[model samples]
Target: MTEATHDDRHPMTGNRTDAGVDTGIERHEYDVVVIGAGGAGLRAAIAAHDAGARVAIVCKSLLGKAHTVMAEGGIAAAMGNLYADDNWRVHFRDTMRGGKMLNNWRMAQLHAQEAPERVLELEEWGALFDRTADGLISQRDFGGHRYARLAHVGDRTGLEMIRTLQQRAVDLDIDVFMEFTVTELFRDPSTGSGGTGGRISGAFGYWRETGRFVVFESPTVVLATGGIGKSYQVTSNSWEYTGDGHALAMRAGASLINMEFVQFHPTGMVWPPSVKGLLVTESVRGDGGVLKNAEGERFMFDYIPEFFKKETADTIEEAEGWYTDKKNHRRPPELLPRDEVARAINSEIKAGRGSPHGGVYLDIASRRSPDFIRRRLPSMYHQFKELADVDITQEPMEVGPTCHYVMGGVEVDADTEQSIVEGLYAAGEVAGGMHGSNRLGGNSLSDLLVFGRRAGHNAAYHSMRTKQRPTVSAEQVKAASAAALHPFEVEGGENPYTIQTDLQDVMQRLVGIIRTEAELRDSLAEIERLKERAKRLSVEGHRQYNPGWHLALDLANMLVVSECIAKAALERQESRGGHTRDDYPTPDDGWGALNLVLTLPSDSDSVDLKHQPLPVMPDDLKTLFEES
Candidate 1:
């Protein structure tokens, strides 16, 4: 199929100039521009720079403190002999099982194969992962890993990983633009045809430090802007994960796939309203923590499905048996995959055995010594002590499901990160079909490493091969600049914070872990109202270092992402991994075989939703599956 081109109404075509005009704004040009500075963005910039391309890494936050710092758990890999016979094949099968078979075969294959090297690469770059006596990187069990495959640095794995990448990027002399937000893409002006004109030219954004608009004209733009978990109030993700990449890509005419499949992490802190939804790392359970009810009963064995029944233990005795003989039995009941644990918790809550916080309790007090708990789960101790005044080593932690990751994102070919939009590419959480309906715990970090480098390499290679410098029209920069600055123009009516809060509340209440058509429709209408209110919302201060103004701008992107999610949820007729529809309580085979693709409509208020066929696996896929 041919690519879609920019319409006459597209902002890029309004101005034509062979030599790119700066519009007197802060003009930065590069061979490649990366929109996020997290793990993927840093890695992409490093790769692009190493490939002899001049690159820039732009982020909305301080250097080294991107959303990646908040990632807990660990990076997934398939290093053999962590358990006997454990390899990429087992990791692949486990991931496919966890995702309910909706994963892109090629992406999954690549991830399982390449993740080990990526993790080791981090080690080579000065990441200090906890190691075993044999001198290999120590591995831990996370939900959905058939073996102990997650390589971690205690519980601050993301911090360790991101710091390594950030330091590496700095070491490589990659241009870093901190506190800059890319609001829109610049398209090539020469191609007027629908499919051809959509080539990406550059990007326009605002610099928080200067309080001025900035534009970059680049031959290639890689969007690694991460996931949209902040769309809901109860999320384990950071404030920076506002789905900027997804929204920006959709607006640029790329199709977003599986948007309805948002993964609600099974264990988030459920107390102290301020930090109520912060993530309690899966590493807690991985280190032998147990989930309990108000009556102190272990309950996951009762909820085990037939698929996992053979591998999983049943009673407390059986679970205890595995700790002694790891090879003879599966890990304890608490270490079941996230979806199973979440459903078990939901069932317990419904059965009136929940904790005081309306969730269940996760306790490790009886399982391990205080020193071991303190050393392995330091963040859990610090988080509870600072946020809830509870010592995890001495007390049971209150936990429940909270929106964490989006399994759905821009649909792309597995090997190539190219989206439906020819010039547009996405990787990491911004690109989808790798995790299917639900992602396993540690897979995300590994995914970033594998795909981020691939995207950077491919984008750089493509730009070099084409030798076409796509120009950002002067008019496109001006329009994007005006739109970005419009948030500060509103001086009265609703506050952006209030509108954003309402948007979160609506999404969490109606379109959350479970959904129905009526609830989804209500969410849509409420979102429209929220969007209207957002237009009238105002910021009280100047743009320089103003979080309020930044939020005001982010709200527009959040609203766009929320609308797409709700619309996609409403259209899908069956329950899938992360997207559970009450109206259609079971998964339909027809729906299971396809992915939902959402694109931004010409009228920005509505979304254009479509379905695309999933890849038909060839003989190689069968071999990979069998070996896995």
Candidate 2:
């Protein structure tokens, strides 16, 4: 993967160095470059290929190992296999409500309408979902949905979905470059006839295996690099979720919306210290697990938010009865949206009602039979047993909130998945405005499929229709390569790992699930201090498979994204959904009227915040809520 430093006659490594004299960098061309290998990236590449375009997938890890593989809950789709009355409208209503009415109406509508089709397509691609007695794909209950909408393969739904998509992509012969970290997006700089300011031209990155530079030149680029969970100390997200796409898009002049909202899932393993932030699948609660305090009381009923009072049961009897007779009784308080449940767990711990490990008890052992538990949630059983040395079938597990998902990201066109940058697009969690303030338990999966396909199709069409070919100057490539190698050149400086860990501590302690103006301001100040440290960060050893260098590059992205989150959180004083401000503890309709948008100017390191009015839902879609 080493780039050729000299022009012409440079030894051929069987890779092109982008159309001309090579600076020794490996270069390739494609109609579309999808910068991720997860579900969304794979689906986007597949769609682009089917739409008559050459596509390549660049990922930070080996195929099939993306964070999407760690998703335990099922894909939310209104398949109605378990409940005949369930449909897309109900799913849409639930999603909008779950997001606290902050979701893009069009995106929510399109996701609900298209998710079932995408799920069925995955089945056709050989995904074997758990089936009902009638041989239809089985659907299960999850938080925020009105019915059994999540089509799952037990609790390993993401693995099955990714495996199926991966196989399909491999079968289609989509070009894949694994272990590559894209550091910079190349856009046209000329403001003349055809300037790069509006469109993306290519991407510059390094192969992780060899630590050499690689360039991907494409007419269109799709960013599907997932979330920013790694910015926090405790998170269910993997190492790859380091705000790559978010920061990359921001650098390329894209705006991020609703950056204040970050979802802390209610059921992460909170014991043994080693696996403190490991995700305990929501399927555990969906399958009748109840949240109890140290006092052995079902404490969720005591913490139900006013917004969900009408939908959630007030008593254990009604809550328990609803599982069997949903038509007559409201859902259990434990089955409330992740934000509400996470806040409740936070409150309990603050009030001295938490378990010995600083979390609340999530018990399914006393409710569901052992056989049923093993059959339904094999992964949870094994995860608890192997990771925490606790058998979930025999005992209640200590669980608490862990940073799970970011509801804000690169703002994009809801229908096409294209960002404000003409040739740049985003999908899955990287794209914003789809989930709004807080995402439902299972909608993340469906959001990927629905928007991934749209982004791919539109990107391909744009690529084919464009008359001009965007250029990536030799100077731009050299600059990218130089920036990547700077950490190695420094003789003495702060360790990248120390800076990252310090940044994480700042985020976890000050800008976490519950925040205050003072703490957020402190976090911003800490981020500024860390930014200086990051500039002086250094790493030992060569680039080849160097984890330190990798973290160094990731640190830059995380710093920018952390600033965006803290800044937005500070501006939005009122508490709503995932962004709970201890200082301002209630939702404010006036604040809801506008989304806080973060943008980075080309000339400045500072992030500018602006208020973008929330799009009014059309009367037709608003009618659905009226009916509810």
Report the number of the highest-TM-score candidate: 2
- What TM-score would every model get versus the actual structure? 0.92, 0.96
Name the regions of candidate 1 deviating beyond 4 angstroms.
1-23, 192-196, 310-327, 623-628
Q: Which lDDT tens digits does candidate 2 get at residues 472-525?
A: 888989899899888887768999888988988999999999999999999999
User: lDDT score of model 2?
Assistant: 0.88
The residue pairs that clash in candidate 1, if any, are 3-195, 5-194, 5-195, 89-628
* Model 2 TM-score (2 dp): 0.96
Candidate 1: lDDT over CA atoms?
Answer: 0.82
lDDT of candidate 2 at residue 456, scale 0 to 100 = 95
Q: After superposition, how far is residue 412 of candidate 1 from its true place, in Å?
A: 2.1
Model 1 weakest lDDT span, ten residues long: 1-10
